[model samples]
Target: MSHSLQHEPAQGVTPTLRLRPDTGKPNVRLRKQSDGAYRRHPDEIKEDCLSQPSEQIKLDISVADYRVVSKRDSEDTVQRMRESMKDIPRSKRAAEVKCEIIQIIVMPQLVDMRYLQTATDDVIERAVEAHFVYSSIYLIPGLSLAASMCAAFHRDWSWNARGVYYRHYYSPHWITGDHTLWIPTIDHDMFDHPQERPRRERAQRLLRHALDNKRWTKSEYAWEADAWSDVFGQIRDDPALAADKRECYMNMAEVYPVSATLTGKSEMAKRIPDASIGLATFHPQHYQNAIASYELDSERLQALTLHRKTSLISDPRLGESDLVYPFLVYEAKGWSGDPRDARLQACAAGATYLDMLDALARHPGPSGKVEGAYQFAGSRSAQVFALTSFGSHWHIMVGYRRPRLKREHAGHPGMSKTVYLYQRVWSGLISDERKAWELLSLIDQIHEWGVTTFRDYVIRHLRSWHKFGRMVWKGDAERMRAVLGKDAATSGQFIIFSLPSWADGFGTDFKAELRQKSGRLMLKRLIDEQAGEPSITCVQGSCRARGYKCFSPEDFVRHCSSVHDNHSGESGRSVVKEVFDQAASDMKETLQELRANCYEIGPEADTSCAEQAWTMVHDNTCIESPTRYN
Candidate 1:
């Protein structure tokens, strides 16, 4: 935020903290209503209309989904969370922290949307410009976090009430700052859009529910202990079974706290929750299927590996066969000794989860439901709200290719992908007993909620990656066109908008600068603008809005008037032939990496760090019909 606060020398001194123009005491005017009700003064409404920044922000978690980010960003994000809420407590003083920050606040955007949808879907619902306010306060010991987030959202519910439909509507009791924002958290048009929400939500909800029944604990999963024991005993007793993979699994489960959830924690005598962690199998039936689909599958890559705390080298293995099935990573060294590596490991697991979605989309699961596979290995009936996880990094990417080259698999082929960093922790560095206890609790949360959230995003991102951009509530599709220009496309009904060009490498690549010398800003002006614009990657046999041959705004205007202007609405929302751009690597997600490593003091020095710098405002119109070309 400080970086943003710092103005160019030409702008004189650094800018002062400014309240959102749409909000603030100056912008608010109260008036009595004829029926004894109070409402915003006309001027207040005008101020909001004239000055309201974008009411929505797009959280690009794909970076966290795909690549590693600066561990420093974690602290920055957390601090930013505090700053944005510095004035939120109008009458109360926040609790203080001693030694370390046990009272951490997660940003509104970073809070997994899965929990939001789960808690709020029934009460609030998803839609365009529906408007939502969500925030989560995490316990170093997270038992209290969920309740706190729900509370925060409810508290902030009134922020956007006046001048919006929500103003006169009775606030649902269940919907509150005490819970995830229940009112629609999207734009007005998204809420008004008839069909987009369901199509996107189907996959999102599928991924969310996939893991509901998958979590296991010592008592819950104890039945599987014998099977694990048998496998371990066989690996230990039989010389042939005593291969490196077997040793790694045995050591990880019994000796090291790799399967910390399953084995019970060694640091603490008794593990609360008594959760049993499971490892992914290298040769599972699905593993073979994933490999089979690969253009070039390496037999040796089937086994997933983790850095061994006991040694510097990483150990490779499929988890003990058929243990309670959650993902596990054990470093004899400790959890996340290398926070980056640990994050990468988590990313690898998340990436694999996407492939699972792709496969499920492409083929039927044990339950024969296309939405998801059966939860348990042998279950004949499939459940809707459950996901199974095994740890394996995959090379199978589902992305866009020219229609001529597009092939049907178990999933959509026209979807390109991007990855970014989300939440991370330098787990091995946790020293305090309180911190350790908190760490175990967090691990359980990750298994039950975290991974599934990532999967849900994978479903959402997969949609966006396939050029179905973020869910466009109401008329945001037109807004998307204004910002993305030729780089964008919309789904049928204009219910969804996608940066299909993103599939062809038009995303903000945060990590690109690592290889870009003096930073991305170092580029020449024209080159920078060109680089920022969508490249001509998609074959425009259909969506002339893609502007395949146009090189200037004039050209685009002429082409639109000639071919797209009149036919622009849903009927004009064309499915262009997708052309895969292998060289297009558009993966720039800017969320934080690891929190434990952020020890510096400045913006984060105070517990309630106050900065609202991580927001972007775009898409003002409640678009209906195709926005005509000027």
Candidate 2:
């Protein structure tokens, strides 16, 4: 039977009920039964439904027959009912049903009342429970009534004890830092250089076109793709913005390891920005030429190629996926997007950029001067600019890691630590003519700083490390001259053998043994060269041209087996066999001592090698454009 009540019927009120349809009963088709004996007879079910008297049964019940109550009264009644239900037996059908409480919190009202109502309705239908059907008018309000109710209930919950009231709040226990200085005031002097006037004028002209054409619509700009490519496309494409060959690259939704959360924290995910401006990727051949000049020993080169080592690459992440020492990051959203989400995303990206700068300064190079190498305003931290926007409103923020301060806390015992800080400097509506030019001028200023100060700091350290490597190479040659005699050591065809990969922190003994073995191999090869019997390349079934010409003889062996060997010698080529064996042995032993630890001194010389090598890959790679506009 079907009956409706808010909680319970009022005193002396008797509500009429009606039998449910036979089709609504549970199906017996899938049940396991012995010869169908457990199933109820169809006639018995039909007779029971028909036994209800016509006068007592109400077939069509409507809301007009029941008393409607306010939401507060309804909530009070539900609480009373819940208390009353506790006394009922556990076996009762009423006590067996479980109810799930779903709360539908609404956003604060905006200028467009209808838009707010529609968005709330869409969220209720799609984001909330989707399977249930409601019959009462209170549960499902009509459009006109819903709009008025939404406006009446509009209240601002923007501020909370922890931080801004975004959908997700950072947990205090998990997130440690002072976010009190959340937003910073804009400093006009930061971007007020005399050279920015022409670029600002150009930005004004392009922005005027976008607004006048009305090319950005609410529907068309529902996603960020249109906002980036159409509305702001001109700003990035402007020749003046990229005058130093630095350009913005879209890195939408690509996760960066630098932004990973602390252990046991599930509140924050890895940071992925919409875009960033940095040293742009160049042609493949230029990259090859640059890496070819690095002349790294075999172990470091293999680790680099496999992306197992990121120290030499100056990449903040495990692999070399992002620009080295990028300076600016961005996050964007369309008309229907949430501004808080955009702000949070921008903060995360900006923090990651700042963290990379910190890493560059902290990484220890062989020269020992690499530590604390990047300092701005006497601090090791560097500033990173962030641009975040939702719809026509845009904001500029500067992110950096504040130095930790020594202080006492009553509640906690440790010293005060500071997390990455992303402080908003300026924000305004892009539709305003004056604001657009000011924002674009700030971008130009940021671009200049990125290519000059930040670029110079990174390049300086990389070049220093490369020069140190050259010194180490020279020292190795001198030591070889003393040990293997000048003629053999200065031979134009000496091999550069590769040492096996060793674990970090505990390979001192093994490293020393390898160095001694490397020296012994060079001495033995010098003795073999004293005979000088025309070398094995002149023999049959060999490559038959000259001595080995590569740093790795294993590669040469593969070259000979594929190009010269006919497989027809069949054990008759003993000299060729000996030559291949000696070449393969030489590939793993010669000149490996050159890559020994920087602490290992040379023979009567302080020529410690480059334990970790760094190079200026960007120097030989990036090609600049010849023209500049403005």
Candidate 3:
């Protein structure tokens, strides 16, 4: 029977332990034999884990019987597992990269990052507390830095990276300079008449053959004349406008011959609606020549597969059933202090578009939405983003929906955890080529950790730690490993925020600071609208904080709403609120749930301030409090 054993240690090391699988013990002390296998022992903690299994079809993790080892062991074990898979093809390999948390490095000055060492656990803990703050989310890039590591270890950004191929960019710093990623992509053409180009091209060829054989009718000739008129607004023979571009011009019969999906986290394989877009490319036909010439420019775009409904721009002439899930999406924007809301709104629009196309999978009848366009927002599952990019930033905020419960999750029934990650913004991977390249290398490392597998890792190993009592990475060996056999495991970067200085249960220290402190009240009230709770004040200002919680989030609209005069309130509260409101209004969607006051998520107050970050520079427009310096 599975039961706890007496306390024991091997050579003064108090390591925890768990069985691999096909075993009975819930927790047991295991030590690696000299020959590299595991055996249970009563008095010794595990130092080394079992070597990787020989069968290499990207080993699956059994959610049940999975015991979460401590954070350090988890990270180390995952890193080693990923290293072992370096020789295997990513499509069948377990993981792609190794990532570790460290003190935020200051910007380049006579720099060499290859030799940087890992920081002590205390340094990591204090750094997270002093620097990774939610208030810094107002500074869009800072939010992105907090999410950088998660994005690096995922496979969804491959779609946008392909877009870079369309534009001419040559950066030598990249490991794969010219070859970023590739997939089967299609682009459609746009004209006044929805199907005008295809029709005219069809007519132009048909007329040549029909008239040559004297098989044309005068009535049909008139109809063809109208089609040509539609094709050419003013010019008589401008075939260039309707002509197909190089990669896009497929003689329908030859498409299957040339089309192939790239292996692993390559977006072609995931094929989500927004990411797996097909384009209609064109070569300019200034003067109709029989020979093709020049580079391709896409005029119209089509969804490779329908998401909720058919895309109006989707070619009625061809089928698009092959594309299924969106693996990556890119939305480029210029730099700004408030870019998050617009970015999220764009994601919302893209998601709405995808839902309509997905409806085709279940209900393929005629719907109000067309093939090319979809409505934005006010729909169920609106914000479920998998891999979406905003400008230069990368984010993995979407949840995956399994069409059917074919696979089992760790402790829950079927694929239990919908949310696969705890971190969000990776837009901060710019300006420093080293940082960006590091992220790219990491992405290349764990490129196969796609939607379903990512969900498995989160439930089987990541969230499993909570099931055991270990809250932080205290070097416990048994608490670290789980049933997961290293195709990929949790990034373990969350350990960066697990220190007690950060809030754990029911809320974040950031929320506490906002609700209890005198400044940023306007920001707090606005946040409270979406995320307030009946939280008891655990600290001295507990009474007033609970009183504020009693009122609806809307009631505390301004700092002075509770007090008539500015003189009656603390000096910085009203002033700071006014300045912050003016600054943060531009990016509301990003801060919608900025304060995660959950014990499971830890506290928001634990995030350090803006000045502590290397990527985000302080503009000082949002702060009015003298205590902010303190």
Candidate 4:
């Protein structure tokens, strides 16, 4: 410990370097380059290094330290830094770390009227092409009334489309034929104007009042009925003296004019007496005085007038011929309590509403040369009419032809034969060349095959074809099992049948013989079953249990046989095997045929029948079927 380890300094180096405590460790020190001085630690050396600098050397200081520097120097440094940063690419900086600077630049600009003109031209061109087309001859009055009503109700009242009204007078049918010819009364300027503010507020208030009232009543009016009557009485007594005031009141009341044109030299127009003016006449003087005296702006007054006139004339109380020039009259009486029964009778008799209308439209008068009245009973008092080109009775009908109730033999409580009659009639009606030919063909086939009812034919075909459809699609048996389970659950009963243990000793061709024999036996059994008198109602034991129900086991078997015959066709022996192998396929085809026929015959008839059938099935809650034992 007393002996010191010393190393001699190199001959060319300075001797002022202090020795490290441990000679084995290297000496570490801080130095300043400016004055060639050494310090004990790197921090001290760093401080000295920062202080000493050459002409080109610049100090990099911490932000805090830089702020402590003289304000003038700090400002100069910041300015220089900013100028340097201006040259750097902005994309290179980290989004979060980058400095943000906002700059505002003011510049003068000029606009070209020609450019605006071109833009406006393009907009106009687009607007013109997008214009909608409507039938001018069919819908003008309704269209105008609709527009006026909307304006009056909205109370953003304006009559900017007065030119359209003038045009309506010249060609009432023109706007009817082409609804697109009329422009919207509410335009951009009128809608946006500050002047519309008060009217809009008033409209809102009125709308709120209407909503709260929930009903239109005389009490809702600001003035009572008697008060209004007194005002009217005053006008009636001093007609000329208070003419201007009366006109103002009427205008404020929002009444307008209506005129009907006599088209194509009509004697009907001349026949209409002048005394019949009533509500139809639009007194021009009344409208003018209202507009002038009420201090109402031109737009508000015009809209009110138009709305009032249209509404007054359109009222049914004005008389049918007075407002609606073309009038067709119909009367309904002497029909069965059940509309369907009446329709069935009509169809079976080879007369229908469609036939009547077609004939009537072709002939107007009772002359021998003219076709007779095409009249049929429609559902209840509602009679639909088709207008001739010149408002005359072209056709008339009393009722829509429909299918009759299904009978018990076809697995329903109604008359199956009567039902079939209606189906046949519908088929004939739908067999028109214009539509439903394929469906008609299917119906013809069903009828030819002697199917008991259209519903039976459809259901039987659906069941049969559905199996085939599943087979063709290679559907999962498990899925079918699940569906069957669901059906059983909904039906609240299970279908149970036991097969015979041993096959009949007929040969490989036994199936064919069995099928034929079964069919014959089915028919014979049906005849036997019909021999017994059936009961309409049931006692405790019930007719079904006693084997004297409307439809017996034999009747059901015979139905199956008839269906099989229709399915198999007349090919005889081969058809038996074919039917067995492809019953589902045949069924699917039959179902498609049924559906096609049903569609052709029109949905109204088919839907009614289906709904009734479904309703009956739903209503008959009891479910009981005897197990087949062989």
Worst lDDT 10-window in candidate 3: 249-258
Better of 1 and 2 by lDDT: 2
TM-score per candidate, in order?
0.19, 0.39, 0.20, 0.13
The whole-model lDDT of each prediction reads: 0.24, 0.39, 0.26, 0.24
- List, residue by residue over 570-615, the lDDT tens digit for candidate 2: 3435544555455434422332422332322235333223222111
lDDT of 1: 0.24
Tens-place lDDT per residue, model 4, 465-571, is 22332222121221111222223223332211111111122244633443343333223323332221111222122233233222333443333345333232345
User: Cα RMSDs of all predictions?
Assistant: 29.8, 26.1, 31.5, 40.4
Q: After best superposition, candidate 1 residue 408: deviation in angstroms?
A: 26
- Cα lDDT tens digits, model 3, 208-317, are 43233222222323322432242222222323222111111111110100011112221111111222221123335522554222212111112211111222222212
Q: Provide the global lDDT of candidate 2 against the true structure.
A: 0.39
Q: Which portions of model 3 miss their true places by more than 4 Å?
A: 1-278, 281-328, 332-343, 359-364, 368-393, 396-428, 438-630
lDDT of 3: 0.26
In what order do the candidates fall by TM-score, top score first?
2, 3, 1, 4
User: Largest lDDT belongs to which candidate?
Assistant: 2
Report how far off residue 184 is in candidate 2 (Å). Answer: 13
Q: Alpha-carbon error at 308 in model 4, in Å?
A: 42
